[model samples]
Target chain A: MSARRGAGVALFVIPALLGACSEEERAAAAPAAPAAVASASGTLDLELRDSLEIGLELLEDGSLRARVRAPRGFAVAADGAELSGVGRLVELRESEGTLYTARFSGAPVGGGPCGAEPVSLALSLHRRGDNAFVAGSLTPYCGADRWHGRPARTPLRLTGELPALAAPR
Target chain B: MSPPHRAPLGLAGAALVASALASSPAAAQEKFALAVFHFNAQYVAGGTLGFTLLPDPELDLDDPTTEDRIVTESLDPVLELYERHPSWGVDIEMQAYLLDVLGERHPAVLDRLRRMAKSGQLDVVSFHYSDQLFIAYPEEDWLRSQALAAETFARWDVPLGRSVFCQEGQAGRGLAARMVTAGYRTLMWPKNLLSYQRSEFDTDPFPLYRLGDAWMVPGGRSMDVTAGSTNISVRWTFMDDGELLATNDMNPYFPELFRHDPASVAAYEAEVAALEADGYVVSTVDDYVTHLETRITPREAPPLLDGTWQPGSTRAVAKWLGGKGLWPEERDAHVRSLDAAARRELVAAETAATAAGLDARERLDSAWRLLFLAEVSDASGINPFRGEMEYGLAHATEALRIASDTLAEAREALGLAGLAVDPESDAVTLATGADPLRGAAVAEAPLAIEVHAGDRATDTSWELVATGHHRVAIRFGAGDERQLWVGFPGDAAAPLVTTLALADSTPVSFDRAGFDFEEFWMALPVGLLSVGTDRFVIKDQATAHLAARIERGSGDVVFEDQTAPIGETATWVFHVFEGSAVDAVALAGRVNSHRRIER
Candidate 1:
């Protein structure tokens, strides 16, 4: 019975893989297709709905490092640009071709509109070919009551792929 | 031999009865012993969540894989003991998290556990979903932990007994009411060394005690109290969880320690055989309770003291609070900040979800689960690793984010989006008309607040932030090194000062003309302070990690912010109302600006 179940699973998976391969082939044949970016050696930009962009770097060990540009009024809202932190890759799922979904939990870092209360960033992105679509939000902490006027999560979204830069050494 | 006649008798009478029973052969045969085995596998290598079977060479026994292996291996000896002595009943008190691991790694072990419980050989007990420090977090977190434990138990089809055990025996004065509210009938607290030393009741007889009312009825019987009422009582049974046995060169109570040691196991088996040979009925707490007679202690029995197993004193909880470098002041501040954030977000999210009639139950449950996991006591107590604290902070942050997002969605659904309250302007209404403390003779004065550190006293100026109706909000700057206190003018006579206990919210009062200042100070673990005559309720801002106490010298209630960072300002709301202290607490929760999300 176990062997029969294995065969049944194989029967279901083969066609799915072939269909995915066909989709990849058709995408490659398309005139306007952008080259697939290597999972290694490049940075991914996650832009939220509010146009707050977070830069993500996938490391050699499958962990992630993230950075966000500080907004005005933040203590570290420096002219120097970004605050960075190492994070753990919470989840990663791949579905044939270049399609994948990734979620990472970043360490709390100071900056943003939340001031000294370190804000943790959780980035979720769906990758298709060169661009990975991003949807992100920020929750203010220092004190819960301090964020009354602020939306529970300041929303962010990433629309299209940006040029990939060399990964941080 | 038939059981001896049981009656409720005073301490003297009970001592006399005990003496008489010691000489009686029939009573000698009625000796009962209960053995409880606690199993926990929350300690993971690198403080990561989840279970694994691959052992880390560095962590050795402390590794999650090894911990699970040890627990699984320890079950064999327990099962053998049950098989060797079928008539004997024992308890396997486990954390719900351990049960989850068992289901995942060793399903057969769970099957065996279920069989033993079903066959009446074992009673399955739990100490919340995870081993959370009940006194450190909010009451809502406690309730959610128990609810999650129940869900885990149901999923495994395990029969959870009526009794609950406190992890590390870290119980408090307020726990009894909370446990009663949570639908538990019996509590098996193995470490009552402090209670035993202070109380008149002798431990030799091991009489069953009741909480909410200070009385011990000599009986092997249990009584059911009205469920959900804070005043309800529960049976308290004390057990010797191997600490006593280890002193006598017997096997230790923790299974992982003794399971692999043949000599220790033999010694434990011999000890059990000796008890049996001595005519003692060794069984589970549930079974042991059925065989005892009732001997009531005095009506003026001492209240149940709060502490943990270690140190065996009322001040044991302070070990977790600070000192010994176990939990530093800085970590305490961070964890407390996260705790306040998670709590307020959860409350607001739930309230908004209800108002908007949103069916986001799954999201809310997830948020609560993360918060409860974050509040596990292991993160701060004992020899806590830095990784554990980080794990807690991460989970807490995620939980806060989920709850905050849920609140936003609920508000949007209710057509209340973009509605906001300026904390600076929206002051709560203060009560007027007459002084509620008129009969108590406590005179209201201006904000005469002082910051005290050692011998130095600094009179801090306050800013009246807002005033409305019966509420007045005052803000003052406090240094990390000093103690912040708010004073009221009163005579030398001490008025009744009452406040809800830290975690459980049971009404705790302090009112002795010259009570020991240290004792009075230790009692008020939470921030809210209410004076006599139902007059004034002084509450600090929800985020502050302040310990409030009635100053012995001046009769003033002081809120000490020991964990406040440098340059931090504390805001306190003074509420005047005519109601009980419990009502004042409820009103404080309702009227606090932090609790409101204006539309």
Candidate 2:
């Protein structure tokens, strides 16, 4: 399937994968990969819905890279765990000039964790003129057992904008 | 304004009285000893163990274990000492953070404190909401701290005393004016006499003097010796504290010290009893000030100097201001940037909220609280822990995020453009009618660029990256050891005015001062060289070590940015406009994109 078609397929498959089970249990279970994850190669300057700017790059190896450029102080996070400067994600899928979906798995940093299990983050970005609206959820799968029956899924709503690319100096 | 029937003691009479009191043991006994106990948890928000020699794993504001230990071990013994001596009035100076921690973790202890304060046995004094370096920040931040302290004290139903006490013992000439505006009547400064000698006080040791107007009194007579702008009458009394005596092996926080050493507690108790038995009135600072007002006359205060208690010099505060004491300059720079950005965003959020008519009281208060916590003095002061510095930066970043979110929502509600400028566009016209530079000049050519590495000058290059009607962006070449200096053609004799230098009422003239220089941070950003007809405002948005100097002989204002992280280009926006430098700074801030929401 084409990268665009694969991304569409992943969009339909994500909810079914999430299910009604708590995030910890689902996170403990292997993160289900889409039927065919799409990969597109290019760099796009994207702004979150709240006006946070991020530089997004899609690599040929089907990995996604997000870089925070402006607001020199901000740090990107995956599943509530702060990323060190740049965040790299796999199981990536993207539609040309339209949308993208990606998942990141990492051991949480800074905050206390019950276990060493890596949490999972599923994110989707829909591109518009100079803006990209995003929706995603972070699952504390690694430390799911420590939740003690508390909900572990954190929903994220981000509106992003893809401004006109700057001319090379 | 002189009171009737009160004799005005001239400078001679003050000196004579001081000499007589110094020689006479009987007169010395008549002097009142004001005892002020300073309590601090030494708490740094979001602090974690391992970075420093902290026994607790976390010193976070929300950590109950740390709060409980401080309340039970450090504070309870002190309160007990006060309780044992009901007739003794002592001043307790602390940050509102400790009070808040008491209210949350140990309410009973807080209640005891409230009762003591109600009965005037203990006077609760707060200089800031958090123990911040207020002089290092803008006056707005100082006001915010006062407001937050007021709110906290009101919530706890504790009396916030009229006297202000800086726990850090740092003071600037501008502090008295700010305190007067904040409704404070007295400043209990323990370090003043240390910075200024007895002779500086007209030979009267530890005399009560009215600040700003510079009046001092000796032996119940007032003398006005210097002129000041802050007409408001506020008094200052200097007392010797335990910290000062610690060099002589005296523990300042005796309650805490006595907790570990029982032998010392008995000795301290005996010393207190002896002091009372010797005809000395053990009084709080408030009572001492009241006594001074009623008994002693006012005299001309010595030159109000800027310093802290440590090092015992007027230049001591310079160590806290980008000096040697504030080490690891890179981390300090980053934290300073975060603090500046947070303050800017907070103002923007407030403005946006007002424009959108949003009732964002709770959210703004939270942001302000975080910002104040970020400004805590210990984070950047002498021997700061790495974890504490990062924690402070974290608070600043969180504050920025909260304020940015509020601003974004307000913009959305008001249907305003969120982006300050087109992110893609390098050039855009400003509505302020300020013209941008179309051409560039190198060192000693048309535009003078002076690059220095340590004491020697170095080679330099520059380019105009972007330009508009009101703004010009220049990117300077980077070198490993070079300090970048960019200058514009203007009158060297023109008055140089900086956002810092709060002591002087008039703009500093380079002609008079010869060479005037100041290191710029977000705390002190703008420097304008006004040439009567035209004004040149250098708005620094780069490193914290950016220094602006006005050379008397060269007839130019030079901006210096030290090389950091080596081989990184520094871009500065110079705005040439007709209006106030403040307006120019605001416009330049937009062009430089100072405000950004976090992702």
lDDT digits (tens) for residues B22-89 of candidate 1? 64533232354456666555543123221122333332232244445445455545656665776666
lDDT of 2 by residue, B296-356 (tens): 4565454333345553332344333333342332234334444655676676577666657
Local distance difference test, candidate 2: 0.45
Candidate 2 — which residues are off by over 4 angstroms? Answer: A1-169, B1-29, B42-45, B52-70, B190-206, B213-259, B302-307, B311-315, B324-330, B417-599
By DockQ, the best candidate is 2
Q: Rate the local accuracy (lDDT) of all candidates.
A: 0.45, 0.45
lDDT of 1 at B599: 26
DockQ (0 to 1) for model 1 = 0.03
